[model samples]
Target: MFAASIKSKTQSLRLQSSRLMPLSQQYRAQSNLSNNKSYWSHIPSWKGVSNDEFVSYRWQLRNTVSDKLKLYKFLDEVLPERLGSTENEQLKRIRTRTNFIEDAIAAIKLAPMAIRLTPHVLSLIDWNNPLDDPIRRQFLPLRSSIIPDHKYLELDSLHEEQDSPVPGLVHRYPGRALFLATSICPVYCRFCTRSYAVGGNTDTVSKKPQKPSRKRWEVVFEHIANDKSLQDIVVSGGDSYFLQPDHVREIGERLLDIPHIKRVRFASKGLAVAPGRILDDSDPWTDNLIAVSNKGREMGKQVCLHTHINHANEITWITRLAANKLFKHGVIVRNQSVLLKGVNNTFTALSDLIKSLSDINIQPYYVYQCDMVQGIEDLRTPLHEIIDLDKQIRGTLSGFMMPSFVIDLPGGGGKRLVSTYEKYEHGIATYKAPGLPGAKGEMTYTYHDPKPVKTAVLEEFQQRQLEALERGETLEQFFAQSAAHLPRSPLPNPSSNQNPLRPQTTSTDIVPEFWAPTPKPAYAYSQGM
Candidate 1:
């Protein structure tokens, strides 16, 4: 009984560490069909909605099968004639959108036992032909909004010039490297930035596109072996986790052998699109993942997982359960979101995403400006809006939850921050530090203030702080004394009387007087917004 209780408590702690409550007991809460069947039925299944309604619903159900297909069709039909005549001659007016049944079967046949399929999977398909608005109301999809084309253009240009250390590898950052581990994804998105790497398109500019073979991975390992500066490697492809568990573990074990490579992370959206792949007990692949993650932990290397989840709704019960499995087995999870137009562009949407990620114990790390990729011009929200959204999100959520808004600089220059309202420059910004209002020596203060008056405020507060200390007052008592009176001496000692630790000086010293704060160039300010 005691051992069982201990096991229960340990499991509970493990769930808590993953930043979500125990979900094994909450499976019933995640019925996808319970309230969604009716909603999904009304959205005009792949048959296509009217042009007006079709475009309107593009952002609304960006992730859904019907919605993505419609958008792809719209682009195929409209973009070439409307915006760029270049794309017109290349393809048909409405290119066929591949459904899961056909695509999954094709993928399975290519690599037998690569992935599992259940009979219930077919039931999950929406075969109903009728459009039902009442049922659609239950899903409450994202609102529609316009985004610019430059976002993808910028991402393309940046990545184009970046040096490829090996085939399918991007080594832009100093300490970290990105490996395009594969070209296959369980589900393909039209806006995928790694266009060349995914969907079996091997025309990546730098490297020759050949069929993925073990020999190629060996080269990747060799590159890592020589690069002493590269301490972290991010395994990303169309989706690294989409590879068979043996393939995944093989990469993990190979990465583990590199003593200098302290961290190996898999960047994927698989957990969102196909959580079953990670959790099904009948699948040997699941055990392989667990083994890989455990081996990573045992080797004293950080086994991290960076998943892409754009909205809160995507964190279904199955995803939560799967995340717990990864965490309990010792893989840390983090989320990197693209700030796409119409989808999570608002503060509320961003906040909810952050909160949900935090609730599941996954750190919300990067709120990236959408990548500039072809056919995704409509998805880029303005950078300024992302800045404002970041401002609103800063105080509302925990530091871990609030992700940094950044735009990968054009021409592969590097990532630059999309400035928030805080206007932080040169790593100099102020927040209300410790101490309460009206506390003796405590006063309204500006942190990192450049002016003398602001400097005097800190000085006076420190003086009073010392005097209060000599009186044998505890730090709490000192703050209370400064805070005791009703806002009197709104400006405490302008000199240094507040703190007795140092001599009071009225005139500001020129030589050592004011710390010359680093001046932020105008271009830095202009770039973020």
Candidate 2:
């Protein structure tokens, strides 16, 4: 009887870790969807899947919408016949499901990062409003929306390859090295800065991947062991989440064993894109992560997870539970978001994301300016967007809750403050990173805004993208050929639009028509909206 009481107490404690007593219940009652709703059921094919099967990591992997064939099949089933439109002129014309599928297919052919989507991310997309859905914009690109690449963009925008002394290891900073553990991710995003190496080869970019293998990692591990100046290591690549549970344990334990290593961060988007994996009792990934964090604490060192979460919609009740479970077991998690043009560039969108993450105990770490990477010009906002957003978001939250608005500089210059530019004229801004050592610190890195487009020629460029695909031309060749034809009227200067003394007009402020979509009156059918 005494043993039974102990077991009962333990179960209650577990519930406290895995469930938000008041908030979860309230959310469930409102959505009738978050806690017990098999939201995945909305997908025609997954209609019969139960909550248990949907939560399993194995099941998620087996059902991942990978490659062109699987994606086309899934989109056909999930997307409504009539799609909603967005104010973004580039995508406003895609009003039907068939049009969207065609654009997606063409975009996949030219995109640098390959198309890969998890069930969770797929489920989050408002398929009814497929064109403007922020989640769709991130993972699946639309060829019709493609714009000419920024002149400064490169396939390997960060110069990770040049910075590597050994394969799969980037030693850009003096005291730290980024260990490329695996060139694989649960889901691939359109704006990945590591476009040259992160995903399976797309037509536009052939990946030189760092496959996840113990033998492959031995060289990276050895280099860290030998380097006395290295105090920090970030295990990232496609993502650390792709690393096996045993692999996570071994890598974390090994890094902790390094004599001079003071901090270790495993970078993964798993928490955002595949939160169910963390909550799955049958899976050991989170268990291994917790073990690593605990071991690091025992050794008087720090081990934490650095996740990428761009928008608030990405955070569901499942994500909250997963994050809570990690926190309950003492895992330190932080989020870094890219300030995309339409996604979280607005004050309301960005603020909502920050608060949602903080509520789940994930510290909002860095809000990055979208990197000037190849083939996703539509996503990259001008440098002023971040500068403006950084100004608007300050003091709205506690100092700790606020994130640093930063730009990871183009061509190997590391992350720097967005507002710290040496010069700003037209669309180009220049910055110097003196904190970096040697010649790097002395260099002035320049960042360019996405090329401003004339409304008259938007359709012309769209035609060029599809024509280039038909001719079997690479995206690089297409951009090079199309650059001179693109309109280049100067965008308004950032200073002219703002007054620090009063309330300001930020880019994110939208009219009723452009504001986020509301649920349909009768839920729009299909087990309903």
* Highest lDDT against the true fold, candidate: 2
Model 2: per-residue lDDT, tens digit, 43-160?
9888998876877789999999999999999989988898876777777778888989988997888787788899999999999987777898899999877765654555666666
Local distance difference test, each candidate: 0.50, 0.79
- Those runs of model 1 whose alpha carbons end farther than 4 Å from true positions after fitting are 1-155, 200-211, 420-529
TM-score of each: 0.55, 0.85
Question: Which residue pairs collide, candidate 2?
Answer: 525-528
Instruction: Looking at model 2, report the run of 10 residues with the lowest lDDT sum.
Output: 520-529
Clashes of each: 28, 1
Could you give candidate 1's per-residue lDDT for residues 137-219 as a string of tens digits?
11111111111122113213344323575666777767788777776655555345654334532111122233457888888
Worst 10 residues of 1 by lDDT: 129-138
Candidate 2 Cα errors over 4 Å, as ranges = 1-35, 480-529
